[model samples]
Target: MDYALKESSTKFETILGTALKVPGVRVDREQFLLQTLGSKIKDGNIVNLAIETDPVTAGIPIDKLDKIANSLIKKRTTNTSMLSFAAGMPGGVTMAATIPADTLQFFGTAIKLAQELVYLYGYGEIGNANQLDEDIRRELTLYLGVMLGVEKSAAALRVLSTNISKQVVKRTSRRALSKTTLYPIVKKIGAIVGVKVTKASFAKNVSKAVPIVGGIVSGGTSYLSMKHMGHRLSETLSESIYYTDADYEKDFKEVCNEVVDVEFN
Candidate 1:
């Protein structure tokens, strides 16, 4: 059992790497902001200016950002759910849990949602989302971990978010986060994810007995899961942090007890 747990956890890390390769998972902050606000903002340069600087710093209202984030979450949720349903169909090419194409796409979509929400809430460029370096990995882990309701990960994010606000220069801030501060948290996340994977409950829950039913379960599960995770990250970014509200922590570390209903092996 312990061996299976370790192997599954190791595979979870690889699964994330594969997810990054999914197109559109890596969101460009400027492009996303421009596209999201373009039709509404009207003025090209003003929108450009907003993208260059933090939206909040450029006087974009918090309520406006919230609207954009909600739209993004909805769109991504629908997309992920559809993919999950398709993958969940029994005898589908990627139905096997080992490969779990739907699971990969789900994370990919979730990452994009996370990026958009982070940008909308006024965070700086989080580095190459595609590249997924150590810092980016740690950052993404924290965001996903928060969605999974990990306490230590949230505390790490709180500290990192505060430090990001204090950063006068990009290099200096990146350097600060690249140290021992976040490593332990990342390790904890790895262990947790590993356990989830080994239990076969990490991906979207699909009932294999009834082919169509599996699709329904997969799709429905993805939609609800993504929506909640998106909201969790959104709230974390918006409140209980230095980015948006003066007091962001209004229960910033709080997470849901049940994130999904996947069956255990």
Candidate 2:
């Protein structure tokens, strides 16, 4: 397809919003943990496990989750690459202001992979409500930001994760995800995404990879890209601390201030 992602915060934000609304796109923490844990975890106990503790501390094996996560990444990468390949078929046309099918699919899979990784690492769902509330959206943005290599996003997530673990709740209501606190961070992340993905790099590469005649080049590129991103988030969540309330309070203030101070056009 001729459509190339533009260098604009609006576009990136729109993509983020759209990717999130897709049916069944967001992974349910309890459901995922149960399925992932399989029979090893007693049915009734598994559901509470997500709210009370993370997967590892609950005795869910890290190796098992890692292996499953790899399979998921590979599967999603392959699926997206195939779509990219199809879109580049000899007669495929690129339309202006249009988002590529491959790009959309990539975000969907990325979000899916992200949620799974968090669940496997022992964090609860970002948001499981019927609506995409501001709180939920903020968390999702942070996840995408982390995937894109934004340090501030990771910091905020660490705070959110620690808070969520402490509460025994389905989600974190911490100000870390509040609009006031996250707006600047969100904008900064958008700018970063715009710079990182804007037709300049991601598009140019994909457009070139899938030549007039479709090929596996683009697919290979996607596989590596998705794997890299998945690893970043997985590593981040794994290392997040759930230790002390005082540490969280200190970290929370610093992260919120730093994120707020960051500016993005």
CA deviation > 4 Å runs, candidate 2: 1-7, 39-54, 90-97, 130-132, 160-163, 166-179, 200-214, 241-257, 263-265
Whole-model Cα lDDT per candidate?
Answer: 0.65, 0.63
Report how far residue 18 has shifted in candidate 2, in Å: 1.7
User: For model 2, how many clashes?
Assistant: 4
| Model 2, C-alpha of 103: deviation from truth (Å) | 0.9
The digit string of per-residue lDDT tens for model 1 on 148-172 reads 6655556556655432432122332
**Per-residue alpha-carbon lDDT of model 2 for 1-265, expressed as tens digits?**
0123224666777677777877767787767766666644565565466446776665556566567667666766677667666654444443324666556667777888888777776665676554356666666767778887866677666665322443222335434455565566666666566556565335534455546534455555666778788878877665553345555566678676776466321
> What lDDT is reached at residue 10 by model 2?
65
Best by lDDT: 1
Q: What is the lDDT of residue 84 in candidate 1?
A: 79
Cα RMSDs of all predictions? 6.6, 5.5
lDDT of 2: 0.63
Distance from true position, residue 130, model 1, in Å? 14
